[model samples]
Structure formats: structure tokens, C-alpha cells
Target: MHVVVNAATSADGKLSSRRREQIAISGEKDFARVDRLRADSDAVVVGVGTVLADDPSLTVKDEQLCERRREQGDPEQPARIVVDSTGRTPTDAAIVDDAASTYVCLSEAAPVDRRMDLADRAELVTAGEDRVDLLRAFAALEAAGLERIMVEGGGELIFSLFEAGLVDELRVFVGPTVIGGRDAPTLADGDGFVAEFPTLTLESLERVDDGALLIWRADG
Candidate 1:
């Protein structure tokens, strides 16, 4: 399966404020651009942190796009997957709606009540012992027939996937604003690499409004 990471960040690379609040980094044009990417993919994945912060609908909003997918004999909407180790995504979250198939990946340590509560709303997959194992989750997603996956993130999840060398491409929409804070979230968080780190090759650049959209590929 092909794994792609997508994010919109500030000029200083912060995804959001220090307290993890959601910020509007992308403009309307960028939103449409990302919606197109979502419409083109087989599945869209995000961490639970994003869910709690943004409460995203996680579906393609354009009716024309949905019609096009239908005409092509594809699902009207791509499957939604959440890497939620603790099963913290509320059962009533937008992702639990019937707009698309929802899959919640969890660790063995996920709460039983939460798991049971979500059973009817989403497909629960145990992927790791204590945290959601991205590799295992990817394999399960592939097995479920989602080969082209897009990851829309909230820092920690992006870091884990990229650090695992699983991302084939990273598409970042850099906005003009800067909200700098020592505890602010960046593109790749967690215990970042110290040596022998992975590198990215700039693949493309396109300016939009006051910012630019950059695409980088994982170095071979």
C-alpha cells in the first residue's frame, strides 16, 4: 500500500498552539485542494488527537467529487481510519457517522467499555500491545482492500509513521501565520532522530495566496 502524509502548518512548522488547540492554518483554497486529495485516495487516516482537537468530518465535501467517484464505481467516500490506542474517540464524534466506513485501530490496552461502545459504530482492530502499531494497522488496512492511503495528522501520529519509514510522500501546506510556543506541535514530534536520520527530497512546490504548498518524497 502507498502511504502519504498530509498536513497544513504555520510558517514556523507548528501544527497548532502549545496547548494542542486546533488552528486554521490552511485557507479555503487549500481546503479544496486537500478535499481533492481525500477524494482521490482509498482511505484517510488520522490520530485520535486530531479527532479530539479538530472534530473533522473526514469526508469529501464536494458533491461533484462524490458523484465522480460514484460514476467510477468507487465508494462515495473513502474509508476513515483512526489510530486511537486508547479508544478515546467519542462514540458520537463526526467520524462515527454513516458517511463512510470507520475503522478505529487500538492497542491491547484500550478500555473495554470504550471498545464495546464503538463496536456498533466502527470496526475495531487491535494493532499493538500498548500503542497502535502503525505497521500492523497498515497491513490490516491493506488486507481490508485499502491500498492507497492518506494520513492527515496531529503531530505524534505523523512522527511515528514517518519515523517508521512508512511515508512515501509528505505534502505540507505552509501558511503565512506564525504561532510560536515552546510546547507547540510540529510536523514530526516524539523522540525525534538524533543520528542517521531519514531525509526528504523536494518533489514539487506551488504557491497559493500568501503561502506555498510543498511536496517531499522519502529519500531512497
Candidate 2:
């Protein structure tokens, strides 16, 4: 399976949406890149916090991105996946009601009753501890035939996924503007492991419009 991470950050390396709102420093080109990635992916996933905050459709809104997807096979919109460890995504949320399909990855500890209630509109899968199991979640998606995944992250989710060593490619567009806040979010938080080192290798770097793009791969 191929996993791609798409992130937009400010010059100061803050990933948080300014004032807790979308469309912060990141510009059109960067958003288009995200749309294109989603157009080319089999699934797009984000954390529950993002779902609650952004309320995004997660569909390819760019016309070019849509056309490419059609030429490639008229692919159905990428499945919207949410990691709602506590089953907190409201039943009426657009993530469940708007997409052709929405998959909620919750913890095994989450009650099955909550899942059953939403079965008609959303597919719920159990995955991590009191949280969605990142590894098993990917395994389930792979088994279900989603070969490529693009992760649109919120802080904790990115941290957890990277900590689990699950991402195959990382893409970030650093916008020229800076939004500085002492506790603003970052693309990835430190993993809890008391480790000597992590073996990471940079794959490529380039400038996309006014933003910078970075790509990386896991060690092995």
C-alpha cells in the first residue's frame, strides 16, 4: 500500500489553522496540490478533530483534478475516513452524510452499539488501544483494496501515524506567511519512545509556487 501525507504549514512551521480556521497561510496552489493528491488516491483520511473543525467534504474540487480522475477511470470520490477513537463524530456530521462512503476508525474499546447505530450511513472499524489502531487500520484498508491513501492530518493523528512508522511518503507545502503562536500545532509531535534515533531519509524537495514542498520515505 502507498500512504501519502499532505500538510500545509506556515513559514514558522505552525500547522494549526490560524484562529482555529481553515485556509490560513496556505494558498490556492497548495490547496490544488492537495486536491490533486486526493483525486489520485483511493482514500483520504483525517483525525476526528479535523472533521469537527474543518467540516471538509474532502472531495476533489479543482476542475483539473476532477478531470484527471475521470480520465483515469471515472474513479469514485476517494473514501473519506475518520479516526474517531471515542466515537465522538456526531451522527449528522457531513463526513458521514455527504460522502459516497465514510469510514470511521474507532478503538476496539468503543462500544459496538454506537457503531451499529450508524451502520446505515458509515462503516465503522475498530483499530489502537482506546484509540484507532494505526497498523491494523491500514491493514484493513489494504485488504479491502484501497492501495493508495492520502492522510490529511491534525496534530495528534500525524504524530500517531508517524510514530507507528506507517506513512510511505510525506508532502508538506510551506507557505511564505508566518503565523507565530507559542502553542500552535506542528506537523508531527514527538513519539513517546525513548529512542536513540529514528532512521529517516529525505527523498526529494522542490518549490511549488510560493510554497516549498518536501517528500520523504521511511527508513526501510
Candidate 3:
């Protein structure tokens, strides 16, 4: 299965501020396109911050969009997964409430008791020491029969996967806004990880509506 990173960025290249604020907000077309991408994927993966900030339903909406999904071979819906190293995923988060299937990846640092609680609502998986492991998580999802894994990330998650070379493709939607936040984050791995995507290369770039969507492929 190919792991795909799909995210929206501002014209200025900021995902969100350090305080976890929204920037580079997408227009209706981009928003709908994102949803369509979710629908077309076998699973939708996101970081814990996005869950807390966006509270996205992760389900394909819009009558026309839903119809298009059916044409694309997408059935009911795709599974939703969240990477929460501390097992900090809110029990009442909409992703858990709405997704037909959900998985929460917690780190070994989390207490065994907490794992039980998370497992009751969503399947609990362990990765890394105190941070989620991008390679392990993606491999597990791939083993579970997900051929197309879509990552909708907060900064840290995106950076980790890219740096680890787990990302097989990248689809960036560039919006027409510059929300300048000094603390805004664009994926951070606090342990000072160096990016080593030595074989990844861009495949194509196209202007989609109000913004440009850049596509890249995992190269050998």
C-alpha cells in the first residue's frame, strides 16, 4: 500500500501556528476535494492535534461528492486512525464518534490501564517509546488491507513520516491565505530528527481551482 500525505498549506507555507491555530484555510472547492480524497482512500490517518482542533467528521459528505465516491469504487466509508503518543485522544472526539472503524496508536510510555480504556472505544496500537512510530504505524495499516493510506496531519506527524521515508506520495493543496503566526508549527520532532527522504521526487504539479496541488512519488 502507498502512504500518501495530503495537507493544505497557506500561500506562505505555514500549516498552523505554534499555538495550534488554523491558517491557510481552504475554500469550498479545496474543502470538497479533501473530503473526496478521504472518500477515495482505504483509511484516513491524522495526528492528535488535528483531531482536537478540527474535529473533522472524516466522512464523505455533499450529495454530489458522495455520488462521485461511489463511482470511484468507494463504498460505505473509510476507516479513521489517530496517532496519540500519550493516549490523549479525547474519548468524545468526533472522529471516534463518527468513524465506523477507528484506531488509536499510543506509546509504551502510556500506562497499561489507559490502553485498556482507549481500546474499549477504538482499537489500541502501540508504537515508538513516547512518540508514535511512523514506519510501524503505516506498516500495520498496510497489513490490515489498506492499500491507500491517506494522512491528514498536524505538523509533527507530517514531518516524522516524511523524514522517515514512510510517505510514498505527497499531495499538497496550497491555499491563498497567509496566516502569520510566529509560533505556528510545520511538523516538529522534538528529538532533532534530520529529514532523509533521499529517494522521493516530485511527479507533477497542477493548479486546482484557487490553489495549486503538488504531487510527488516515492522514488527508489
Best by TM-score: 1
> How do these models rank on lDDT, best leading?
1, 2, 3
* Model 1, residue pairs in steric clash: none
Q: lDDT tens string, model 1, 1-220?
A: 9888999999999999998888888889999999999999999999999999889888999999999999999999999999999999999899989999999999999989999998989998898899988888889889999998999997899989977778999999999999999899999898888987889999999998899999999884
lDDT of 3: 0.77
Model 2, CA-based lDDT: 0.79
Candidate 2 residue spans exceeding 4 A from truth? 17-19, 190-199
Clashes of each: 0, 3, 5
TM-score of each: 0.97, 0.89, 0.86
Q: Which 10 consecutive positions of candidate 3 have the poorest summed lDDT? A: 188-197
Q: Which candidate leads in lDDT?
A: 1
Worst window of 10 by summed lDDT in candidate 2:
189-198
The lDDT for every candidate, in the order shown, is: 0.92, 0.79, 0.77
Taking every candidate in turn, the Cα RMSD to the unseen true structure, in Å, is: 1.0, 2.2, 2.6
Better model by lDDT, 2 or 3?
2
Error of 2 at 71 (Å): 4.4
